[model samples]
Target: MDELEAIKVTFFQECEELLADLEGGLLAMQDGNDDGDTVNAVFRAVHSIKGGAGAFGLEPLVRFAHVFETLLDAVRSNEVPATPDLVVTLLRASDVLADHVSSARGLGDVDEAVSASMAAELKACTDPNAAPAPAAAPVEAAAPVVEASVAVPAAEALIGADDALDDDDLGFDFQPMTITIDEQAADVAAAAGNVWTVSIRPKSDLYRKANETALLLRELARLGPIEATLDASAIPPLELLDAEAAYATWTVRLETDEDENAIREVFEFVDGDCDLEITRGEAVATDDALAALLAGSAPAPAPT
Candidate 1:
């Protein structure tokens, strides 16, 4: 391969690792783990990528990376400082970045809108006192809402899920939603920094290979307190059930000190083998709300 091609390949490989670390590092910071080395590692990754992109003259990549790298440097030098808002913004920028790279690889500029939005957001995030860097405008939309209503995408600095559906190449057939939590699960969740409700459907190959849905729920229990409710409401009984298919649907209330990521980590071994949706839950304070205290604290009064 030519030098440019080699660099591109390495860039892509290293970038994937970098992005993963960036995300994990950001998450760590959110949970009050401010490790300077983690922040430095993320900053270096962006800086290196920007420098390399500049040498290669990939304008789009270099342009965005310049702004992104600036924000990283700001955080690294403690010029801007990391706040929860900054962490969230940075994470969203990471998504916009995924869109940018996809466009670079010929994904048809699907994310120009997002890129512009993030660029504006980043500009506001850096310190005015720091040596300033060049800026890029957000990508413009051709058919913007009206002839006169173009809201400028502002620039600023740094910041910064799951649903499983029967997804085809074109659209999706959403499965039913389920929620559950047992007393033991509540205790576990109360102990943890957070808990989440997660639902998953096994992949097509999973059923054919004898993967048991029940077993997945049981395994999830070990990570913390877990109560599993079977959503067999969709199941057909007796002779009508598909013998080879997975019949048990589950809704789990998991309690743990784990962050959103750690909650997702429980399903690590089964990834791509199943579809999952996990949302961070509202912080449940006090155990009386979860225990079977029907007098006044029974989760909206047991649905009447």
Candidate 2:
């Protein structure tokens, strides 16, 4: 196959894996394991699919995935509860999403009515008070109404007479800001001279997306002196290896007074795409102890 065709094939293959993860995570939540990581996994799956679809100009697939993702984001941010009804709706939406992927691959056509119906259901989960669009309502017609209703209030708030408005007038309470600084805390941190251990294990998708490990390491090095070790224990024999799969992980010992957040900022863009942890402590006396600490802690499974 040509390069474009090959890339398209790879994207669909990744979609299959992501869909499996999405389904598995949803099932776990259904079984009462609704943790933050599980919610993040589901969000990442849809997000990756949407990103790939957009690259290929799969407009319909992207559009539906975008709506599906918005609802998932609400659940992630705790704006909406992961109630039984919402989970059921999300699973049904996932099925439709799979159909959308198939249609994008030219396997078959998705009925407009079915897609529209599912989209409306997903939208309802985002706004509990909002009703699903009538089945007879045209998709284009219903979409504009929803968009306008949401946009108008925001526009009015910005342009409305500010003198006439109070904190309560906006339908939500507003609190004044406060800021304080503790010089003693800063002095203690500086005096402690603590070091941090940063562990990172990136999934294959990170490389596939052209994220450079070298760049991440360089960024970390900027924060302080870093001794990095690459672990290739997971690599298979050459003949058994898949070129696209990631098998290596990294363990880095950083001698920096930077806070944990500073270390995490190096990996913020890839927050959900990899496994990362930062812990602060006194510097280790030997490399072996650091290695043992790194090896003893099992890395979270990389994104599927």
Candidate 3:
């Protein structure tokens, strides 16, 4: 077998491990283990599969995983309450996901009618308003390779989406970074057709989840042209750096007329993993006092 084919083998090997984690986490929830971390682990399992499938151009796996991931996200966010019925549905979805993996491996064909039925059910759990569909789009029986494995690294290799954390010396102090937005320019930028400044500060959990910053930025670029500035000030020297630590932040100037919600969807998957702030116009310092006041976490300023 060629080197590229070998990488595909590695990905499938990783998928088996990930699928095991998915099943374990879902079962934990089903057994009344509604811990936030448990739900996150379950979400990461599906998300990692989706990322790997996308790299391999396995459309069927990616599509089904996306729908499954969405529902898991809702459960994680508490948007969809974890009811007994919901847990059963999640278990069923997990089974279908395993079949997709097996199908991708050229083991056997997946039952299309059942897969489509599960997709609709998963989507409905996330969005009750979604239109019912008889079936999903036609998917290929044998997973095809769109690009050489070397050209696109599998998500499993980049970083684990959900690994148990251990205390290791970071070798440097970690401080959170904030983006400053200029108030006046922001006001003008809030107008139609003006630019939007978005700040993203990812935590260690984001990288732990195997999310790629480049992918998020690429999604943002779809809205309009974007100028991104990386904040590497918090990054320690190589000798002092922690391999597991996420240190860089970004400030992006997007020339788009899209609403804030549109910009938000780009980073939805990493919602709890990062600190995000979106503003219109130029740059200025973020006022901690004002922010606290706005959030209703602190009292208002006294009138002079």
- How much is 245 displaced in model 3, in angstroms? 1.6
The candidate maximizing lDDT is: 3
Q: TM-score: which candidate is best?
A: 3
Mind sharing the TM-score for model 2? 0.45
Off by over 4 Å in 3: 1-6, 9-84, 95-192, 282-304
If candidate 1 were superposed on the true structure by all CA atoms, what would the RMSD be?
23.0
For candidate 3, the TM-score is 0.50
How far is 238's C-alpha from truth in model 2 (Å)?
A: 43
TM-score of each: 0.40, 0.45, 0.50
**Is 2 or 3 the stronger prediction by TM-score?**
3
Worst 10-residue lDDT window for candidate 3 reads: 147-156
C-alpha RMSD values across all candidates: 23.0, 22.3, 13.8
Better of 1 and 2 by TM-score: 2
Residue-by-residue lDDT tens digits, candidate 2, 153-260:
112223333546656676644433222334354335336766676778989866664455665676677676566778899999999999999888877766566788
197, model 2: CA deviation in Å?
A: 55
The true-versus-predicted C-alpha distance at residue 51 of model 3, in Å, is 6.0
